[model samples]
Structure formats: structure tokens, C-alpha cells
Target: MRVRVDDASAGQRIDNFLVRVCKGVPKSHVYRILRSGEVRVNSRRVDQTYRLQLDDEVRIPPIRLAEKAAEPVVPFGKPFDIVFEDEALLVLDKPAGLAVHGGSGVSFGVIEQLRRQRPEAKFLELVHRLDRETSGLLIVAKKRSALTVLHDMMREGKVRKRYLTLVAGRWLNPMQHVKLALHKYLTEGGERRVSVNSEGKPAHSIVRLLKRWQSYSLVEVELKTGRTHQIRVHLSHLGFPLCGDDKYGDFSLNKQLEKQGFKRMFLHAAKLAFHHPLTDQLIELEAPLPPELERHVVQVEQTEEKEYG
Candidate 1:
């Protein structure tokens, strides 16, 4: 991918800037390309630490991203619940059981299906990611220019996301905040686990109890840091794992949820706030709770109220 340095990216190191702009580029491969002269700034081969100047033209040879591959052709015509879209980006309500991009035994994903619809579109990129089992709003960039703009917004911490979830305990407080340090690693069994390690990265989640039931609570969450599974991991560590979270939750609760016709994780990305990639207008998108989650929670809450009263 060829890149031109602009005033916004001025005075940044060549390697650092490239890694930020090019998604999924490994550190080693980035340096390898720089050393091998595959990357040129101002038509000259520079070291990895080369400091970029304003308006410097860069020539970047096509480099493969080892972590991501060309999306396979698998049912690319599947319909999507589009929330908002323009020439620069697409906002869609990604349902549970839909994979954002192909991986982890999912042969075809939302991106693949989108590509099939617009064959002439190039650089269809995801601004943020959502786990396959989790449902909610997702943003996809229609052009590379818009991709960079949206990414910069996220990196600068300007983008905001809100989630709604039902956790395994009755919370009566108006607001509950979890400030915990998270250390993540692959367990001996090759599954990911998070613990409250003092040496871990600092993480914080502001949770507010919107309602309570006999054995569950509906909470709204805001993320201060975008760690992997930050909300789920932190909540689980706090001993209130999300309902139907099979990986880090109670097995019996999961079974009960399944019996209630809940087959996927009980989580949703309910809202998104960010600047329009092309128009620079402040944009906010919202998706109401899916019927399954709404009805399930309502029933649970009503039963709990009657029993407790």
C-alpha cells in the first residue's frame, strides 16, 4: 500500500507511522520491509527510525498481511441490517452469530458478503471489531481515505462505544464502576484468561445498573480502554460474568439460558459515537435491543419482582 505523509502525520517516525496506518502489520515485517528498501520516503531508502517530514511522498510495495487474508467467497449475498451508510463508511447492526471478518472456522463473514454486493469497491476495511458471538453496531469503511480518518479518531480516543448486558447478579445501585488491572495470557490449555494482576495493564469500566431482576441485572457499560474482552474479562473477574458467556461464566447458567431459547452470548454493542470519516460531522448511531434479549430480561425481571416483593 502506497502512502503519502500529510500535515497530520508530520514529524512521525517512518516505521511507527506505517504500522499505525497499515492494519495488522507485524513489527518484524515492518522493519524487514524498511531494511530491504521496500519502503522509500521522498524516493530514498531510509532506516526504520527515519523521521518523516511534512508532505513527504512515500512509495510502499505491496506487502502481505500474514494475520489477514483475502476474504473467501462464501454466501456474499447475505443481507445486513444497515444503520447508516455513505460513500465513506457503512454502519450496520451486526446480529449475533455473524462473524465480522472471516476467522475461527467462519468461512464467510460480513465483509465477504459486503464485497459481493459491491464488486468494484476497493479497500473495504473495518474500523472496529466485534466478537462473533456478540451482536451490535459495526462500522466499515468504504474507501481507504475514510479508513485512515476513522482509525485516527479511534487511536486518539475520540470514538465512544456503549454496550448493554445482563450480568449474573442483582445490582441495585445506579452506578457501579470496576477499576481493575488486567493481565492476559494463554492458559496451558490454550484458552485465553484474564486475572487481576497488579503488574497488568490498567483498565476501567463504568457500569450503571439500569434494572434488576431475581438473578440478573441489566447494565450499561462504557469503556475507557479498548483491551481485548475488557468488559467481559473485567466483569468476570469481579464475579458477575455476563449471562450465557460460556467461556468465562457458570456452565449451569449457560444451560439455563439455552433452555430459555438464548443460544448466543448475552451482549450487544448498543450505541456508537464518532465523527463522520468524510463529512467530519459528529455522528451517533443506536440499535435497540433485539427482541430475544429484551423479552428474556423482561420476563426475568418481572418474576424476580413478584418473588422478592
Candidate 2:
């Protein structure tokens, strides 16, 4: 079957378009067809990353949809806390412990729930991703054009993302810039991990000391280059892993912190600044620290004062 791409559909990766258009089809199957040259764009075989253009024709091969029993039942729930919203975009203060989108054992995620809530909405796509354990301001595009422009802005370093985190140990420097090369690899259990290696992609982060406690420091981190797990890996390599980070952290320390009422990763996306994709107007958004994190900070300060004084 042939599908014609329109302005609303343009700029989306072909694989994503297929996944939406061919509902009930497994993502793995969609990728397989692309790799096998069964899917074509404008009568030519195109890779999955090929962005659809206006008037481009997509050729889809016959495929069987997953049986009703095979599909997971994703329940609709309460909407996320909105930090900002307009016709072109949505900024949400995503809470920690919720995956951005469903996968990797998560049956439903923020995007899925949003889609369920706004079933009448035509276009909604994640502008970027955050780890399931990290909470902060997240952007979702309401239009395909917005998504494309926002992606370009990120690539051009025009978008600014700042995060707040608590790390083990006293960070001495008022501010320090970390530039590390990171390589991604899987462990024996097929779990994804990252390490500093010469062969890895270049990652950059600027960490500023915010406050210090007896054994931990709160920091503000700015990402110059967004690589997977960049902030966590960089801090870990510096011998100051993030507090409550289950992966790449001091496990014993995590347990101790859990006993102290800090059970979740102490990383939050606090601020985001960028130009509106369609309006060309500057936009800035922030999410306040969650109550639990705020309480943890107060406790840390009180503990430090009592110990030193």
C-alpha cells in the first residue's frame, strides 16, 4: 500500500510514522521490513532514520497485526503536571519513577498515558528523552514542524538544559567543566551501560557546586552535549557519583541513603530554555524540586549543622 506524506506527517522518521500508521504492528517487525528493503520511500529503499518529506510516498508491504491477546492493555490515568503549554508544544514536570515512554518492561509511560488522555489530538511526540528515574521538565511537540525545528536547535547547541543533582563527596570546585568521551555497551545480562573510552562519542557537562553537606554536595549540571547517561557517567568517573543512583553508584551508600528516607535518584531536570520552534519567541521553563527531594535537602543541612557545630 502507498501512503502520501503531508505537511503534518513530514519531518518524522519513517519508522516512527510506520509505527503510528500501522498500529498493532510490533516495532521489531517494522524495523525488520526496513532492513530487508521491504519498505520504500518514493520507490527507493530508505533506512529507518530517513525523515519523510512533503509529497514523499511511502510503500508498505502486507503485514499481520498482533493478535488482540498479544497487545498489552495500557490504562489511562491522570494527566501530568503541566509546566507550560501552547499549540506547538507541551512542557511537563514529569515526576521521578515514571518512564517517558513505555518499553523495557514498562507497559505504559508518560507519552502513552498522555495519548490516551488526549485521544483526539493528532500530533504529539517526545522532543527528547529522560531516564525513567530522572524527573524534571520534559518537552513534547504538538506539531511535526515543531519537533523538527527543536531537534535542529538541540543539534546546533541552541537549546539549554540544566539539571539539579546531589552527589556523594564534597565537590571542591565552584564550577568545573567535564569533557569526556563515552562509549555504550551492554553487560552480560544485556543491560545497557556506558563508560569513558577514547572510542566513545564526545560528551560535555558543566557542574557547579551549589551546596555542601558533611558527605554530599548539591550541584547544578548543564549539558553542552547530550549523550546517553552523560551526566551520571561523568560524575561517576570523577569519583562523585550521584546520590541514590542504582547504576554506576556506590550501592552501599544508596542503601544507607534509602534508610535516611532518600529512596529515589536525586537527579531532576530543573530548567530548560529555548526558542519557540514556530514562533521564534524565547521560552524558558522550570520545575520546582519535588517535596521529597526538598525534604532530603533540609535534612542534609540540619545533619551537617549538628555534626559540625
Candidate 3:
């Protein structure tokens, strides 16, 4: 069967395009078709990496759908808070402890739930990502045109992302720039982890100290390069691991903070700004710190005063 790529589908990899259009097909089978040249773009056999263009004709071979037992039911997810919405985009205030999209043993996440709730939406895709434990503003694209434009803005350094985090140590620098090369590797347990290494992808984060207590500092982090665990790894390498960060954090401090009612990682995506993809209007959005995080900050302040007084 022939399928025509539209503006929204343009720029997506051929393999991803196939997976989305061909529901209930195993990923292994999708790659097999591509390798066998049964999947063609514009009458030419292209690799999975081919970025589809507008109006490109995709040839899909017949494939049997997985049996009902093979396809597990995706549980319904309650809708998250909507920070902003329009024809082209949706901004959500994602809470901590919810995965943005499910994979790696997670059954359902924000995107799946949103799609389930808005079954009539012709297109809905995550413009960017957030860690499962990180709470804050997240962007979802409603149109393919908007997704393409937003990606361009991010590449050109036009997107501004700011995060708030409380770390385990007193950060001495009022303003510090961290340019560390990071390498990702899986632990023996098969879990993903990143660390500072000489031979790795370059990463940058600008940290501005906001407040300090006896043993912790609240800081605002601006990402210059988006890398996996960039903020968490950078802070940890600098001896200021984020409070309650299970991975690359101070375990003793995390336990102490938990006992104090600070139960989750103290990292939050607080602000996002960019030019509207379709309108070219400057857009700035903010997600207020959740009550739990805000209250922890206040608790830290009270402790600081008590100690200094």
C-alpha cells in the first residue's frame, strides 16, 4: 500500500514513520522489511534513516498484525495540567513521578495518556522531553509544521530552558559555567548512566546561585547543550549533586531530606521561551514550582535562619 507523507510527517525517519502508520507490527519485522527492500520511498529503497519529505510516497508491504494477546492494553492515564494550548502547540505542567512517554518497562506515560484522552486529535507529538522525576513545563506539538519549526529553533540556540534545582553542597560560585564532556554507559544492571569523561560529547550548563543554606544551595540552571542527564551529571561532578537524585546523588543526604518530607528529586523545569513556530511571536512560559518543592525550599530557608540566628 502507498502512503503519502504530509507536512507533519515530513522530516521523520522512515522507520519511525512506518512504525507509527503500521500499528501492532513488531519493531523487528519493521526493520526486516526495510532491510529486504520491501519498504521503499518514492520507488527507491532507502535505509531506515531516510528523512521523509513532503509528498513523498511510501510503499508499505503487507504485514500481519500482532494477535490481540501480543498487544497489551495501554492503561488510561489521567490528563496532566495544561499550561497553554492553541492550534499548533500544547504546553503541560507535568508533575514529578510521571514518565513523559512510556518505554523501558513503563506501560503508559504523558503522551500516551494525552492521546487516549484526545482521540480526535489528528496529530500530537512531544516537541521535547523531560525526565520522569523532573516536574515542569513540557511542550507538545499539535501540528507537523510546528514540530519541524520548533526543532529548528532548538538547533539554532533560540530556545531558552531554565530549571530550578537544590543541590547537596553549598555552591560557592554565584555564577558558574560548566563545560564538561559527558559519556553515557550502562551499568552492570543494564541501567543507563552518564558521567564526565574526556572522550565524550561536549555538554554545557550555566548555573546561577539563588540561595544557600548550611549544606545545600538552590540554583537555576540554563542548559547550553541538551545531553542525557546533563544537568544531573554536571552538578554531581562539581560536588553538588541534586538533593534526592537517586542516581548520581548523595545517598545519605537524600535519605535525610526524605525524612524531612522532601521525598523527590529537587530538580524542576521552571521556564521555557521561544519564538512561536508558526506565528514568529515571542513566547515565554513558566511553571510555578510545585507545592512540595516550594515548601522544601521554605523549609531550607527556615533552617538556615535558625542556624545563623
Candidate 1, residue 96: the lDDT equals: 88
Pick the winner on TM-score between candidates 1 and 3.
Answer: 3
Task: Report the lDDT tens digits of candidate 3 across residue range 50-142.
Answer: 999999999999888746766446666666789989999999999999998878999878998898889889799998899999999999999
Better of 1 and 2 by TM-score: 2
Q: At residue 296, give the lDDT of candidate 2.
A: 91
Query: Model 3, 76: alpha-carbon shift in Å?
Result: 3.5
Task: Tell me the alpha-carbon RMSD of every candidate.
Answer: 5.2, 3.6, 2.9
Q: Give model 2's TM-score versus the native structure.
A: 0.86
Mind giving the per-residue lDDT tens digits that candidate 2 earns over 96-168?
9999998888998999889989998888889999999999999999999999899999898899999999999
For model 2, name the residue pairs that clash. Answer: none
Give the per-residue lDDT digits (tens) of candidate 1, residues 79-148.
8889998877889998888788886677878887787777787557788888778889999987666878
Enumerate residue pairs that collide in model 1.
Answer: none
The CA root-mean-square deviation of candidate 3, after full C-alpha superposition on the true structure, stands at: 2.9
Better of 2 and 3 by TM-score: 3
- lDDT (CA) for every model shown? 0.82, 0.92, 0.91
**Predicted structure with the largest lDDT when compared to the true one:** 2
Of 1 and 2, the candidate ahead on lDDT is 2
Order of quality (lDDT):
2, 3, 1
